[model samples]
Target: MTPTALTPPLMTPAQRKLGMVLCLVTIVLAVLDMNIVSAATVPIVRDLDPVHGVDRLPWLVSAFALAATALLPLYGKLCDLYGAKRVLLGAVGTFLLGSGLCGAAQSMDQLIAFRALQGIGGGGLMSVTMVVVAHLKDPEDRGAGRGGAMGGIVAGLGMAIGPLVGALFTDHLSWRWIFYVNLPLGLLVLVGAALVLKLPATAGRRSLDFLGAALAAAFATTLLLVTEWGGKDYAWTSPEILGLAAVAVVTLVLFLWRQATAAEPVLPLSLFRIRVVRLGFAVQGLVGMGMTGSIMYVMLYLQIARDVAPTTASLYLIPMAAGMTAIGLLVGRLTSRGHSPRTFLVAGAACATLALVLLGLSGPTTGLWAVCAELALLGCGLGQLIGQLITLVQEAAPAHQLGVATTGIRFFQTLGSALGAALFGTLLARVFEAGEPGEPLGAVRSLAGAAREHALGSFTDAVDVVFLSAGGVLGLVLLLAVRLRATEAAAGVGEEDRPVLAA
Candidate 1:
């Protein structure tokens, strides 16, 4: 059941080398744009509309994140219909266009709109790159799922370094440079892809499921809005959030119905019947959920509690990035020696869980090195899980459904990240409030001496609770990962329970 090692026989060494570089660059452009703005928001607000921009700051992030997440399913279907090369090139062109627009924007409103446009293409960058990888794999590499393995490592590196990269750009040049940088990088890569990358076309022409795409988009949009706006912009029970939630529920039901009945469904419901497919989706979601606490909240802890500057706090992510990069490389080598991906999956969940527990136990007195160590451990777990799960599902997926299966992993993870942000954010606020009654979490910044110390302690405790809760979720992920059978033979032993592999 293990994927055999790949021999680089598909193309000349130079062509493969160039193609790989292009893939990595495209992926960085996509994933980095997701978080890079967080570090430069202050400068952006100051330059655009000092007073009003502060109020609308979150939209800078939400615009990209929401648009990117909502369009993922459609992008996958587009790849299937139009071929990955055509779709990927289009996405790059669109992204570059949006980046240029963003750089030239004179107002915050214009920037936000441009960001949405950027996300339209950014949506396809990460997911579609993997599809391209699948297409680019050698005939001998069939079922290796090694395609996503490198994707995971690069993605982890991108995520860890995003804020730091943003800070460096904003501090050294201009906030707009962050947007401008993508132009040259993307343009060069697009040209290289045109020349060096050779990929397969679609099996045949098929009708585009416009209605299914619309319904699915509606569901994802409303659900993301519910998560983003709830508790912060509006009360959970407020009409706006409630209205969005209702629409999300309604559209979800409709989307499911459409998937079941439509002849050319955008997302085929039958894919869920495959055991690895189902497990992969679920595991990726939980990983996203846990990441809200591990990645985002760690920055909060450093900046608010430890009084580190934002840029400096971002530097702290290096250990985690290093761990992800190191472990990811090691896994590729180990798997090449014919180890099952499940071995790493289970081990990764356990490692991440242990890391979360270590993070949860940290307090104000906890040394900075200790925190870094915990993060490294977490990264080790993530490196093992992120790409390996994709590889597993990819290897197991029926060839005809490759695009859908690939995108589904990312879709669930994005949705889970949204939900996790909402849940952990509320939990942190509530727990901190309980510790320091009638005090806002931000009040710790103003308090001095004893009061400040007390508030910081409370805030620390709240963060700890979040880490522990995330750890608990990873623990659940561990159990689920354990349920994953090592081989189709194991699953096929019971005909009634065996996964339906028919596309």
Candidate 2:
């Protein structure tokens, strides 16, 4: 606690700004790589299996989702133990290696394996980047630089540009170029990480909990498979559904028991003691469920129901991103001033609910402008919630437990997405089975020149059902948001964590 120890080896303001910019660039690279591969699937499928017999197309996406979500906690724990810089650099290296493998894949199986590898790297990037941000300043100033660099630049730009960038590359160059795009970005991030990111090594006397990790993976895989395949590939009542549900229950219960007794558990059971963390996680889950269900169906409606081309449909997402970016930046400023976060969550969830209802009301008769308006509203609601929630989680928790706390919130978010897809998918299947007054699918089949028209009509009906369901869920989230508390972190906590250079 001496003055010399408290003093940072000084750097100029410009130097610190440069360091922060470089670190954020790493976040953008990781996030861009996360969702870009979706646009390259057509080229990959055509080259690897032109006949289209392989049913693993969805798996290519799902494999990455499962790997990334499941490994979040693992990487977060490693970051806390080994130092964020080392873990982040290692993850970036893995990501670059995976990207190279994906570009060179000769078959669908190879591509999927490579994508899984990419996810392993990506999982670490998201968690550790946030942790680095948390470590940069005491709780007070943590939310300041985050608005531009972390939230708007990294998350907003990455989410918006991913499909657009991927489309451009896949169209003009080659599908492989989408994967190849990561090389320069990843290399640059590696250099920035090596030079600027610094943290004291702090691995405690805990064994790596490999058993807990395997069990957690099993639980997540079973749940995801049940969600993905149930009601779509097989009946919900079938043996496959029942078996997977049983496995999920058993594995999750076993993991929970192991955590309760483990001397140093991977996911510490004690972190949930904070009421704010508990409520924040619950709100995160609900928001995730509503958002994912709504977005997926909207995309489906655009492409299948409206008959918009993939490139055009991707462009339509601009309103959502734009709205989110505007509101997210605004909220970041307000929340940094110690504004009550609960109010923002409630207002945002209400906005989302209203947007979903508007989408439901539109039916097939809605114009493109009307649909875009609805998307914009939903995006605005999301802006107030997403970036703010992560910042709140870090500020509310004890410093050393920051990684696990953030990972827990992320786990719930992933769970919500999986559940939303499964639940909404079931609703769509039921709506199809019940059918409208007329046979919509058959009418589409019977149409000669009107095939696309009737298909669009059926999609309209499905969207009506799905969006209405999402609206109801968001309304519930609004109610839950009322119970969430905005914890006031102590003043001067910021100086304790300030870095020599911006982390």
Candidate 3:
């Protein structure tokens, strides 16, 4: 939003606090929906359409991610045109509506469709909440991109706990409650928004690139479909996969062309000119992919490969959160004593990469404590890198373009996670099929003694490849992290506003 757009009223300190709390709640809602479904997938499939749902299960995850990611750039632009307050409330209401529909879905197709609808709302929750946050802060206190460093930590924490929450609901109540529970929480946030939020309104003045938004969403959706279906659902060379790939490439070219020519592009290509912004986008995307690998696949590893129950598997995240908390405290002191944020980034990436390597080296028979240690190390790495990347990007961007720049990095991150889910799914299926020929990963449940053990081993080995691939990607993030240069754009922030990740 334009800084001068209808100068916001002076809100009391209490009101500001309430507003910030509401924003965090929205973050929780978005991040939880992204993750909470994973733990309950088995039950949902069994109840919905067990016959064909097994083959379409990945869609349950991918549909939300794709729909959430597809319109991200446009959401940023919308916040610029309309105020954050209106956009945020609209998103929350839509998400609540979608949640209700998801709870009532009767078939796998219905559930996936509802998830996409929910994602249409979930898309706005994360990005727009940050926009609201920027408006809520005191002008002097306001830093970059809605002061998103802190939100990143909150998001990471939510990602850690979502499965546990999902497991608890699925264990004690039912999987449908996962979506139903959002209703009360979302309604509370809506009330808070209505009561306390004090933000500028800017609807009539800005030029929105409607066509540009359409092309961007089309490109992203097609790309994800190609990734999700290629080599697994269809042969890589088959007409279906080939046609999707062709559509993806053409849509991408058209989107780029439109962005170049549009009056107000959804994502301005000029932001990429800034080195910090460019590298930060790559860092966030790789981090998103790594986080997805760690959080999503770990449950699969524990539940299927090791035969652990879902609730017990979710408890394992406690170690990861503990590690992040410990490292966050240590980094707080080090940065205060005069350390570089870039130093932390490099160190964090190295640690996370090493942790992935350690995880990749493990087998189904590995001890629980040993795997926990690796998760803790991974958490330590992530705690350092996640929040700092966006803070750096927003600081580097020009103030007027803050909304798109902030949302743009998040857009890439969500896109990365979506692609990772699809790509990793394909890899897992192919590797498992190669070793067992005809047996699917799900067949381990029905096999006896030796066959079950062999299937579990093969599945674990396939998961190992996913971790190894993620590790190699993080190794690249480490390289980019090293290339970070200190600049005046970032130097403007006060010590209080700088590198709040550790704080």
Clashing residue pairs, backbone N/CA/C < 3 A, model 3: none
TM-score of each: 0.92, 0.88, 0.84
After superposing candidate 1 on the true structure, give the runs of residues whose Cα lies further than 4 Å from its correct spot.
Answer: 1-14, 143-145, 486-489, 492-503
Q: How would you encode candidate 2's per-residue C-alpha lDDT over 1-503 as one tens digit per residue?
A: 11111111243445446556766777777768766877877787888887762578987888778788878777766665666667788888998998899899898889889989888887777767777665554333554435322464355567799888888899999989998988988888888767765554454544577777777778888998899889878889999999999999999999999888876566777666665667678878887889877888888778666668877887777898888778777766676676655567778888999999998887766799999999999888876666556766665665556667767777788888889988988887568656444454435434556655655566577779889999998888887666554233322233443222223
Residue-level lDDT of model 1, residues 1-503, one tens digit each, is 32222222446756766787788899888768876888888999999999888999888888888888888888888877777778889889989999999999999999999999998888888888887776565554544546555765786788788877888999999999999989999998789888877665456867878888899889988988998899988999999999999999999999999999988787888778887788889889998999876898998999998898876888888888888888878877777666778888898999999999999998888999999999899988988888777777766665556677788899999889989999999999999999999999877999999999999999999999999999999998898888885535467333432223311
Whole-model lDDT values for every prediction: 0.83, 0.73, 0.78
Off by over 4 Å in 2: 1-16, 138-140, 143-149, 336-343, 436-459, 486-503
Our model 2 lands, by Cα RMSD against the true structure, at: 4.3
lDDT, residue 136, candidate 1: 60
lDDT of 3 by residue, 1-503 (tens): 22253225767767887888888788888878877998898899889988888888888878887888897898888877776777788989999999999999998889999999999899998888876776576544433323333554565577678888898999999999999999999999998898788776554757889899999899888888887777677888999988988998998999999999988888888777777778888889988888877777887888998888977887787777667756666665565555656677788899999999999998988998998999889888887876667656755665456568778888888778767777777778888888788896777878999988888889889989988988888898898887664433443434432222210
Question: Highest TM-score: which candidate?
Answer: 1
Q: Which residue pairs collide, candidate 1?
A: none
Model 3: how large is the Cα RMSD against the reference?
A: 4.7
Any residue pairs clashing in model 2, and if so which? 138-494
